[model samples]
Every structure is written in structure tokens, then in C-alpha cells.
Target: MSGATSTGDVLTINGTGLFVDDRGPKDAPTLLFVHGGPGQGSYDFMHAQGDRLAERLRVVGVDQRGVLRSDPLPSGAPLNVQVLLEDFEALRQALDVDSWTILGHSAGGGYAIRYAHQHPASVRAAIYDCPCWDSDGTDRYRLPIAADLLERYGELEAARRCRELAAKPERLDPDDQSWGAMRALGKRYNELFFHQPDNTDALDRIGSQSGLTEDQWRRGVSHLPLLTEMYESKQHLLPELSQPSLLVHGRHDLVVPPDDVQAFRDSVPNGRVHTFERSGHFAYIEEPDEYAAVVTDFVVSAHR
Candidate 1:
């Protein structure tokens, strides 16, 4: 820890050091970010919107356990949903905060929702940013959208393959269809994830300056193939999050299709959906000021 309110720190907890970028006033309503990617560190998030959200909320973004910035999972150690939530609880106690709002982006949304379900008393509200609640659902649904995008980009053959893959009930990752299509797109593959390619460049710039070593950045890969069939079955156990929830989506986000976003909103008892018409998966980077404003407004009201 650097200071009383250090924006960057790697604190040792449970015999493991986890990276955290904690900012904003200690007295402010805290908002903890549970990143997606299962392994994608919070570095990009902290770099993108940490300062902006910190201006109004005590924004806390941590690379999930065994993810970037955090120590790798030890041999014979486990990385189940329960243990991941436990680590957040540990961080809460370490920070001395009673409760805080949580924002989960992409795959992180799964983790955030589980955290809220497991520790409701410690969570004030939930925010889902282009969340992937069901990996299989998203992987399959995104295929048709990817097909459409590929077709628009003039990769006719690849687009056809995407459509074929979308028809199947088992396409669970990029390797299924989008990967082949994206591979065809060559460098332009990144375009499928962004509304504006220029904004993709901006996000890339932030990541470029992330200062995380390549090895640390890639450590979370170990989590991708873990046997979480047990927890994966129960991930949707809390279909209706009781907390005041906000679901944000980019109209152009192919990965988490519009139907899923709509379904998420309908499932929430007290939920609101905000769409960034001009963004893709990363609205915070594509439209930072607006994203921060929307999130800040919802978070402040929810905190009260």
C-alpha cells in the first residue's frame, strides 16, 4: 500500500498478494469492480474509468484471484466461485468498508452476480456491463451477430460459416465460429468487438500503458479450462437479483447480443437498462464521460 488512499496496491491476503487500484475518498460510497475474462486484470478498467468513477464513488477494481496482478493459483489450490467470492470478502474486511456497490463487466458479470447472491448484506447494488451471464448462451447467440458483422465487412465465406455455427446448440467459444471468421478478418478481427475501430485503438492504448508484465497479464489463462461444471450449473441460481440493478449495453456489442441484455433487464425486479448507441463492448472507453455519468448517477442513488 502506498498511502492512506493509495490508488495502486498489492496487498497480501490469505497468503496471496492481490492487485487493487483503489481510488476516491474513503467516505464516498464505494463501488467495487469485478472484471470479466475470469482472468483479465482490472488494469484496463482502473486505467479507463477508475479516475472518473473515483471522482464520485470510492472505486475499487481488483484483478480477480489468480488473475492479472494477483498471485497465480498454487498447485492443488482451487478456483471455484465460492473461493472467488471469499477473496472479495477478504478485501472488504481489509479495506474496512462495510458494503459497496459492484460493477461486473462481461464474464465478470457472472462473478459479480454470484458475489451479490452469496453476500447480499455486503453488496448495495449490482451493475452488469455487457455481462456474459451464460457462457454457452452468449457464445451461441453471438455467432449470428458475428455472421452479420462478417458479412457486412465483405467476408462472405466466413459470414456463411458463422451462420452455420450459430444454428448449432453447442458453439461455446470463439474457436467455434467467430474465431474462424475473425481469423479471416485478420487484424480487423478486433472490429467485431468495437462500434468504432478508433475507440478500439484508444482501449488498446490504455492497455499498452497498463505496465503489467506479459507473464502477469497472461496468468489468468489458467482459469479458462478449469473444471467449474459444478458451479457453472449453479451460476444462474439467482436469476432475479433482488438488489437495485443497472444493465448497460452497447448496441453494437456482438459478444453479448441484444436479446440477452433485454432478458437480463426483464429478470431484474428493480432494474434499468442503458444502451450506448455508439459503443460496442467497452463503452467506458468508447464513451467515457457518458458512461461515467450514467454509472455515477445510478450508483449514487442506489447507494442511498
Candidate 2:
């Protein structure tokens, strides 16, 4: 039972050791959390809602390969959508899980949708929380608000840059994105993630949680170049989803557009939308109680 139920266990899949925190009763319905930021770890979600959800669901949060708790990708090796999906499949097989309910947050939504499409039999249901289903949609809707915030925060130059980027052709090449301008948005960028600009205590609490080495802490820096692949992939699958899906979006979310979330819901064959009226990008952190209730309710009732 050492590795079976341990909160911190490493599963070596495809020769890379992926960190997995598996909790709750083994026989309960399993829910695997797929984190975003391309290579961001699942610790944030685990720290925020792991215990609450684990009581009635098998909460498994595995930091994607090359991210926080997992092994970093080898130099010169490509890390793309297919590789991530294969990794998840391998991890599932390693855990002896026949299937799982996937909960994808932010950019993880792209991967979740693709995983459900590719392995329909392996996904009982999916929960997309504040999902960034399409990068185009994200920039189209998020940038204007971000620009306004930047201007309000007195970062005029960055605000001008955001306005410029947001006005470009909708399908402009990914290379054309002004990441430097975005970087210039600086600390003001954090305001975009919450309904209450000052309510970002969760970010600090989650980022500073112990147990990761220094190298693991910075794995996302190595993944910056691979995010274009995630963006391109998410743009195509909303129309094809046929499973019972719950799309949760924060009403005041400036990270991913709320309207875009609704559009995604309308496109899916059996998709439903739940808006977190008082939350922003991180609904779980902003409105923890309601977030727990909705997600748990969906997991328990979605397949029935």
C-alpha cells in the first residue's frame, strides 16, 4: 500500500518519472487533474481542492511531464500535444485505471478535449474549469480587458502594446504574438486573473507550497517554446465533443473570455456551461465552496 495510496508517488511512464498524488478511496470514481501553463504542475489545484474533492472522488493530480513534480523533457526532444496525450495514456495504464474523469483548467482544457476525443472509452466525463479552449479566443477577448487594466495601473506602454496585438487579424501566425509586450505587462498581468484585483493570495499560497526541488520549480521555462502547439490544437475540437461535458467559466474572467466559454458550450453535442459569477480565472480559489459543490456535483451526476 506504500505507493498505492501515498499522496506523493512517482510513476515512471515512458522512461520519465511523473509525479502523481493519488488520494481517496481506490474504488471511488477517479478524477485526474490536467494542469495548464503548458508545463505547470498540478500542485495548485491539489493544494486548493484536493482534500475537498477526494472525499467523494479519487483525486489524482499528476504534474505534466517536464513540469513541477514530473521529470523534465530531455534537451532537443520535442514536447507537443501528442507526446502529452501518450504520457497520460501510459500513466493511466500504469495506475491500472480503466478510465477517469478529467478536470482540465485554463490551457489544460485543450488537452482534456483532445484526450476525450482520442480516448472516448477512457474518459467517463470531463470538467473544463475556466478553460482556454482557443488561444485566438483568449487573446481576442482577454487582451482588451488586459489593456484597460494595464492603462488603469499606469502601464501605458504595455497597454498600448496589448491594444495593438489585440487588433491584429484573428488568425495571424502564432509567431506574430508579441510575448515581449505581454512580459512587459509585468505585475499588472496578475490582475487579469481575478474578479477582485487584490484577491490573489492563492497564487502565493500555491506557488510557495513545499516539496519541489529548485530545478522542478523552473520546468515551465523550458516549455515556453512548445505552447504554440497547445494553442493550435485546442482551436479545432469543440465542435466534435460528444460526451457529457461541464464548461465552468468565471464571469469576470479576463484570462479567457466568458462569451467564448459559452460559444464552446453551444458547439458541443452535450456540453453545459456553469458561470462563476464572482470568480475570475481561478474559480476554485476565488469561490472555493461553490467551486467544490459544482465540480463534485458534476462528477457525481454527469454520467448518470
Candidate 3:
């Protein structure tokens, strides 16, 4: 598979290291893709979209800090909003791109918004797909929409478990229970969020390809409670971002809820939102052609 041959190259930031896999022509307008998951690295799902996107612009998918193929995060680094923002800056600097567009998915949207807010100068435009930003660090953003899915699909137990974990923030760390919870969440996330329920296999494939151990995946998920704070605070951060942006979500997305996405679109000063009727959380993977075309057009149109 073309995906297997695409090895990530290394870049150093703050004397620590990071990894990124590049596709498309060097001269094309750079599109930096931020993959979801504080733990999920840039996988083939993102890579598969490359040729289609590269036809219009350059694309680089980054496996952000502590994820597979990236440098181990610094021992004491807080793994909070500030650190991630800084890492993005470091990435831009290391890549020597004067400006770039960003496309963020799921948790990636939160980071992209934060980075755009903090470094408006470096961004040309941004795309937020199924963003999970709420005011507080709770899964309330997901609950109302996912309620039926949680109840009908027998995921209520898992949903409640996730909520319980969120309620007890201190429980987020590498442990058997936390790992187990993430696995369950991943299974449900695939079914509840993606158009095709089978895409959950992509995560497993990516995990294997990226060489992430079960421990790393679990540890990465354990931080979701801490990270969801950033996910939920769209208003404060979105208003601060001056970059041109596009927000797309699946109408059927029980994960982030299209309502939340629409609300965010109305509020962002220079933003637009598109809904994918057939998709859920993984719209890009589910509706790659439309997703890529809309994003490519948007980014190129916004490029100065």
C-alpha cells in the first residue's frame, strides 16, 4: 500500500523531536493536517487523501506530540493547551513555512483553533471538521446527540463509563481500566461517528503500522479528560482566531453534534460550515471526495 511506504520524517522542536510525513509538491501551498487523538498519529486515512488534495496544493500530515512516530514528549511538559500551541509554532518554524493552512479533525480541531488564535500570523486558513469544542471540559457536547445512539446501540454502558471517567479527571492515566475504556470508546466511536462502521479497523491498522504499543494508546486516551477542556472552549478561542476558516460536521455525528458545529459557525467572524448528511465523526474518511474538494477549494481561495 502507498500508505506503508510513507515514512514520517523527523524535525526537532525545542531541542526535542517530532515527526511528520509529507506528500504533494514542495511548491504547492502547504496544508498542515492535524490528526485527531492526543494519541492517534497521522495515519493512512489522512494519507489516502493526499493525491486528491495534492492535485491542488501541498499537504503535510503531522503526528503531534506524544503520538506514534513523533518524539516522546518531554518528561515534565504539561500536555496542556499551552504546550501544544508552542509545539505547533515550533513545527512551523522547523518546516520554514512562512504561512500555511490547517485542517483539523476531532480533537485536532481544538489544537488548530488554539494555534490559530495564538499565531494568527502563520495561518492562511483553517478547516474544523466535527469539532468537539464546548464551554466546559465535559462530554456534554457529545451527550445530547449521542444519547439515543448510546441507549439504542447498547453503548449506554460505555457512554456512562466515559462520563464517569470524565467526572473523575484524576483517573486519566495509564491503567488497565483506562486502556479498556479507550478500546471500548474506539469501537463505539467508529460505529457512532463514521459513515462506515468498519473504519474502526483503520485505527487498529494505524496503531500497528505506527508501532504504538497498547500502553501508549491507553496513556494517550487517559489524557482526554484533561484535553477535553480545550475541546469544549470554542467561543473564547474561536473569536480570538483571525484566520479564514471552514467548519464542517456530519449532521449525523452524535460525537460532536452538528448543532454545536453550527453554533460555532455562526459565531466565527470569518467562517463557514458544511454538513455531511451521511457522515458522523470521520467525515473525511467517510466522504473523502467531497471533504477534500471543499477543503482544497476553500484553502486555495483563502490563500493570499
Candidate 4:
């Protein structure tokens, strides 16, 4: 909350401290934002669009159970898909909200989908932005696209590095500098996330502006094990999610392909897909106005 203009608070739920930044009128429809980066905190999203979306809906950006601003989980804490879902439920109950919409970005989409499937009664609707449906899809579809984009953008060295990393069948430990370097390269060449190459700076700026400390960022990345668990146990449970859902993806998204979005549309009973023609992984960042309009329309219509 250091750089946030919105009201922020820390809630101790199930012995873990979760940080939340709440904006907009309290009476407005609530949206719980789940950011990507099994480790990335919600501060970036809050800094980027929290206030903008807050005008029409109460936006609550949260640093997951052990991300920036939140107390770090124990080194041997039990982490799995179900535990994460339970964390969301505890936050919802502690907030005293009957139910809320979930806005999940990138990897966070997995969490949102699973939560909707497991706790349909607590979720009114779900909005996924360039979501990674599952680990298999990401490994099969997204990574190749990302490498291709890097090569096409003249980042040949980055592309080479990525390819080398990809070729390694063994999983790299989260604490490894090589893994972090690969992640950085991926972010650098993810063209679909921004309309212009210069705009890519927004990605890092948001995190810096949000006042995320170095220690917080490191602690967040420590959850790489959780990410690995998600990838290994990934499931295509879209059909099980009964709540209304909106799937938004960039046509050029290297992280989540259009085909995956289409698959999500095909599987979910109440779901629709919107393609950002000129955008990529971070559709909301690339086309904020349009993204907001689409989300507002979808949520409003779903409630009616």
C-alpha cells in the first residue's frame, strides 16, 4: 500500500497475513484480483488499473498468502491447488462479502478457474485476461509462441537463451539465477503484452512504483514450488466451473494462445472469449479502455 492511492489493509486469515488494497465505493460490485506469477504480488495491477476500474466496481487487489506485503509462508508450508482455493475462501469470508467476481490474469487464471469450480456459490462471475488454462497448454503452446516472438523482434540472443532453457527437460529450481534470468528474458520479449516496444517499461515500472521491496520480490519468487505443483497436477476443469465467465486474450499472446481461449469457451457452460486483436499476454495493460469496457459490460450483464 506504500504507493497506492486506495485504502489498504492486512487481514490475518488462517495464521497468514494477506495484504489487500480496496478501492471504489464500498457498495459497488466487488472484484477480487488474482495476479499471475505464482509469486508476483498484486501491487502491479493495483498500481496500473486499480483506480481506473474502481470508478465502476470496487477493486480489491491482493498479495496472495505469501507475496509482497503479506507474511511469508513457512519454508515447508503446505502448498497446493486446494490450499490456494481455501485461502481465497478465507479472504472472502473475512471480508464479510457474500460473493464477488474474480478477475484473474495470466497464471492466476488457473486459480480463478479452480476456485469457481470448487466454490461456485461464492463467485458471481470470472474474468480471465490472457489466462494460462493449464501447464500442459503453456508448455505446448505458449512457450513456442514466446520464443518465436522474441526471434521476430530481433532479440535473437534472448530467443536463443529461451530456447536453450526450454530444451532442458529438468525443472530449474526457483532459487536458481538461471530461472530468474529466463523469466526476465521472457518478459522482455513478450510483445503481445504491449502495443509498442517502449511500453514494455510499464511492466517493471508498475512493480517499482508499487514500492515492492527487494526482499518481498525474492520471497514471492520463492513460491516457485507451488507453481511447479500446479503445472504437474494441472487439470482441464473448465467445464466444471458453473459461474458466468469471460475469457479475454490477446490474439498475439505468447503466454496464452487463442486456441486455448477457444477451448475454454467450448468447455465452460457459461463462458465467452474476447480477442484483443493487437495485444498479447497482458491485454488489460495493452488495451485498458477497451478491456475495462468489456469487463464492465460482462459483469453487469451477468448480474442482471
Off by over 4 Å in 3: 1-6, 135-138, 144-189, 198-200, 205-225
**Could you give me the TM-score of model 2 versus the true structure?**
0.92
lDDT (Cα, tens digit) per residue for candidate 3, span 177-263? 433443454446456556666675665565577665665555455345445455345656766668788888776675465456656
C-alpha lDDT score of every prediction, in listed order: 0.77, 0.78, 0.68, 0.73
List the candidates ranked by TM-score, beginning with the highest.
2, 1, 4, 3
Compose the digit string of candidate 4's lDDT tens values, residues 86-174.
88899889877888999888788878888887888999999988776655446545455556766776777756665665666765433
Note the residue pairs that clash in candidate 2. none
Error of 3 at 160 (Å): 6.8
What are the root-mean-square deviations of the candidates from the true structure over C-alphas?
Answer: 3.1, 2.3, 4.9, 3.7
Residue 293, candidate 4: C-alpha displacement in angstroms = 1.5
TM-score of each: 0.87, 0.92, 0.80, 0.85
Between candidates 1 and 2, the lDDT winner: 2
Residue 7's lDDT within candidate 3 is 58
Model 2 alpha-carbon drift over 4 Å, by segment: 1-6, 233-235
What TM-score would you give candidate 3 relative to the actual structure? 0.80
Task: Put down candidate 2 lDDT per residue, 1-304, tens digits, no spaces.
Answer: 1233336777888878788998888888888999888677888888889999988888889888888766677898777878888988888888898888899998788788889999988898998877766776677677777778778778898888778888986663467565456656676566678777667556765676655567878987766765686457364587787678888878887656756666776688888889899988889888888998898888888645
Between candidates 1 and 3, the one scoring higher on lDDT is: 1
